[model samples]
Target: MHPALIPEKHPMCGKYMEALVQCRKDNRFSRYIGACNDITYDLSLCLVKEKKIARADRQAQWHDQWRKKKEEDEARMLALKEQAAMSKSESPKEVSSEMQQL
Candidate 1:
């Protein structure tokens, strides 16, 4: 296969891509009989590896963001609970003061 036909998504496989291209050029006739098979296989494997690494990094980042959002939500809920508790504690004094006046 021509190097130009290869996808550009895997920078890590550039060397493998070059090797395959060279093999094809060196064995223009033999290439039709599997002369570049090994190079092509190696390039495919490298691309697969790069893809897996990228997916893992993306997953880790997503998990970190999700954990941070959950932590912030918990803190906000705790703050609201504390605010409610404080208001409840102050209500009885206000009610008693009103009763005394009545």
Candidate 2:
């Protein structure tokens, strides 16, 4: 495979992949006899590491979204409570005026 093509498919393990590909090309006959085993192993390790990093990034993003949503909900609840309190405080005065008018 072309070096450019390998990077496009495995961005994180591109170098390792390309090295293995080159090794195989250099030892075409021995490659089938394990000449490129070390490079293959290294490529697998790189893929695993990249996958772990991706998972951690996704989790962090989800946590941030959850925190923002919780903050918004708390703010909304506080505003509603303040509105309820204001209405409660004003209702008695209006009731007293109505009683006096009667």
Candidate 3:
């Protein structure tokens, strides 16, 4: 499995659906094949539900990281602008002469 694609843990953590499927596959309830099939179907539904929850959690984390980085960048830009403004105020004549020279 690709490292990025691999789930950190079984997607069905805390879910009993896998155990139900395994019991059916193992023929634990041999007397009723219909019951086994029903259990398997239920397991499939649980798996889908767990996967959706995991996917949403991962997306939320990704967006949070992006938001934090964006905020840091904006703060840095504002600091730089403030520093430039302060320096310009302290040396207005020099800056004006330099602009004329340019």
Candidate 4:
């Protein structure tokens, strides 16, 4: 899930569902398996209800090229910073060498 999506208020639903599934698989008895299946179905319905709660993405990305452009821009900015730092360090050495030549 995207970071922007609101976290579930009841996070234990998935765990509960998993446990129900496992119990149903291990138990051959009809009553227990039927009970697990019913509970799982109810949990599924409740989880589905969350989709109806309207929410907006905090970090919006409407365009198709947005991700690619963002990545490229970050990479370019980093490269530029590195290049500038390298040039700054090399300049002092070059200046000293020129002074020696004179």
Clashes of each: 0, 0, 0, 0
Model 3, backbone clash pairs (residues 3+ apart or across chains), number: 0
Q: Spell out the clash pairs found in candidate 3.
A: none
Q: After TM-score superposition, what is the CA distance of residue 35 in candidate 4 from its true location, in Å?
A: 48
Decreasing lDDT order of the candidates: 2, 1, 3, 4
Model 4, residue 52: distance off in Å is 12
lDDT of all predictions, in order shown?
0.85, 0.86, 0.68, 0.63
- Which residue runs does candidate 3 get wrong by more than 4 Å? 1-48, 93-102
lDDT of 3 by residue, 5-87 (tens): 22335555334445554665678668275656665565557667777988999999999999999999999999999999988
> With candidate 1 superimposed using the best TM-score fit, by how many Å does residue 89's alpha carbon deviate from the native?
1.4
Candidate 3 lDDT score at position 66: 100
For 61-97, candidate 1 gives per-residue lDDT tens digits of: 9999999999999999999999999999999999999
Model number with the top lDDT:
2
Give the 10-residue window scoring lowest on summed lDDT in candidate 4: 1-10
Between candidates 1 and 2, name the one with more favorable TM-score: 1
Give the TM-score ranking, best first. Answer: 1, 2, 3, 4
Quick one: best TM-score, which candidate? 1
For candidate 4, lDDT tens digit of each residue in 1-98?
11221225546365555566567677768745375666666666656654433222423433536888999999999999999999999999999999
Q: What is the RMSD of candidate 2?
A: 4.8
